[model samples]
Target: MGGMARYDALLVVSFGGPEKPEDVMPFLENVVRGRGVPRERLLEVEAHYQGVGGVSPINQQCRDLITALRPEVDLPIYWGNRNWHPFLADTLQKMAADGVTRAAAFITAAYSSYSSCRQYLDDIAQARAKVPGAPEIVRLRHYFDHPGFIAAMIDHTREALDRLPEEDRDHARLVFTAHSIPVSMAASSGPSGGAYEAQLRAAASLVAGDRPWDLVWQSRSGPPQVPWLEPDVCDHLATLHAAGTEAVVLVPIGFVSDHMEVVYDLDTEAAGVARDLGMRLTRAATAGTHPRFVSMVRELLEEPEPLPCAATCCPAPRPRGAS
Candidate 1:
């Protein structure tokens, strides 16, 4: 419980997004660098950012989360992003200059996977390697099924359910969604393998409770020939409609904030799919600045330090076309 004794600061690590049209492509390039993502795919994703004024909600959401966390946590809070301004290396440099010797990192991502868990750790390690005297950064434990997180999600899902027509509310199917990764990544995630999907299903089950629910994937990228998790949200929506499911609530349990994926993929693309199918749909908000969720940060900090993941855990995928 002596968080202050163990760490001098709290570092917020998040997936960054572009703040302007011109920054979109560059940011996307940083995201897919060395990953063999086609330029065409980058351009396609770029348009999604442009459609919303070329601003990603992620950066602003990070700012908002830090703002909310400031009052609850006693230590100085710093933020860093993986692929945009306020990059991780720069943030660590600042932390070093401020005399911060050690810090606890609260990554925006909650689950275990190559991208979600290990990649962020790798980013921190890489960033620290670049900064002289960079503070020792320890990541908070995964909170996919933490009570605070589940409570916030349940409340939001209920709010979304209430938004439906009274007649449809009772029959609305609960559909939990997360970002999709390649099948190889999913299979190899975490220490023993398959931890990514298992953790997600656990969180979804907790959030769904006694309600009938289904887990689906969203925001898939990369070549079509490569396999990723499925059925995709839009595709799943169509199937539900065909099965006479007239209404549904989408709980984006995979994301922590209403970033581009939540706003664009679920709200824009998936919403369109439901509209076309004449199915009622409402999306539960992510746990952005939710009071309970905000308090969870302090709770994580107070807990005993977590064990670091093994090197083999969530190993980075080989680049596309790599033998």
Candidate 2:
């Protein structure tokens, strides 16, 4: 019975972050529950959160986006997260209590990957199982190449380039970044494989236009032995600096907000590397609350309802102990 007209609510699903100083460890625990990230590595990630006073700006960003969407769409908006407070299960409970029967889910991540795509699917499935009378959730299609999303990134990329010296602005290399999943996961991302990298490349290419650019990985969490995507952003920056490049613009095409990964990893760590290298580096803003992006959400809802991904699409990565 569910078609385009069957949805009763809109859900903005996101990768949640801690909002206070005390929620760091628990939030990190939720993030790395399984998958065997070592203790030292977990502590290091915890430090990244603690360094920022234990607050990740992601939750607030989600709230801001929803607030912006409230007026544009008629459906009641429900927010949920995969990692932190306002968990998906809790949100679904609220939705069921509110008598919502069906909802359209708009995940924050644009590209495809295990963590970005399938993991969220699994989260939705688990949450629905936990909450009785939970609404059927239809996830919106991936908008990596959506015109509105591209426009927002283009605007931000231009703004970031303008921040560089005029002499270097025109020649600044566009360095696009995305989260680094394990090599195995990256290889098996889509129905066939390699959808994660392929989508990122497509997005980066659109954002670059005539400008020279490279796609790089960041915030890799697995063990050192496990190979993930190649050419880490920071390392790529160093490579550019070594090659006599004068300036660069970092576009975070993979994410929709300036969460810990964008703030700490790019702004703090990578920017520090650029400063030491004397390379003028400016990071582009994400699509958070960008007018075009907000409009895009409304547009997605109006379009023909997106068909669900195949069960075989974006399969979960191989477990750590599996041979």
Candidate 3:
């Protein structure tokens, strides 16, 4: 195991997505369970999935990542999702059956937030509780700022910029985006608070370097009465168009792959907005199976074990209608 002596296996954890039209609603229900999301809203999001033939690219991306990591690490790599098939509990059952005692978990999310960080840990804990003899699954540290991740983004950003018209390339603004969480959840993220935005800003800065850039949010899914992150990607594109910005490169730094959000939100919705405004736009690819990114997994695995999150870090949001 080399430096991974404390762990017997590496498990890839991700936010699951539906594989077919029939599976869409059920998969979405699992995602929004107990969050009080309106069925109307669920159907609206469901349409986004159906429009793309009801398949989410996330699960396949996870498989590709696992395949890339196999040659880099010696441990048996297992895959599991929080909401869809190959559920965490089932994966844990298999792990236990195989006599795997302890494993290191690498979540697809790279930042700190309730949904991105703590909720995953909570999910793992809950799954372990349900499966007898579940291995001690320790999540790897947040790698939003890791050099390997940054390098991958930088390379992809360059590629996206190249796709723009030659005249627009030099003047194109870089707009980095991520999923937006509710305001209260964002405020309570990480050990102290605001770590979600803080970490994202740090990563965005590293990716943008000296380029003119702005960080925005996308794919917000909460009641209108509540506020999540502001200046959504599409809205920002409109604003940039109005401000006479001719072209932009959208860097989805918040996501690890071209999942549904990246495909529907940025590639579809945001692209439509840009088209309406007659502004040039192209989206930078996520860090999906990039060589440097694949190597990063092994690096994280070989590093010294990470300390557990503080009890209050990235605290979950109180359920809707709570006192």
Report the Cα lDDT for residue 128, model 2: 100
lDDT of 1 by residue, 50-124 (tens): 998999999999999999998999999999999998999999999999999999999999998989999999999
Q: Write the per-residue lDDT of candidate 2 for residues 55-144, one digit (tens) a residue.
A: 999998998999999988888999999998799999999999999998999999998888999999999999999999999999999999
Residue 156, model 2: lDDT of: 97
Each candidate's root-mean-square deviation in Å? Answer: 1.0, 1.4, 1.0
Q: Which consecutive 10 residues in model 3 have the weakest lDDT in total?
A: 1-10
Residue ranges of candidate 2 with Cα displaced over 4 Å: 1-4
Per-model TM values vs. the true structure: 0.98, 0.97, 0.98
Rank by lDDT (best first): 1, 3, 2
Better of 1 and 2 by TM-score: 1
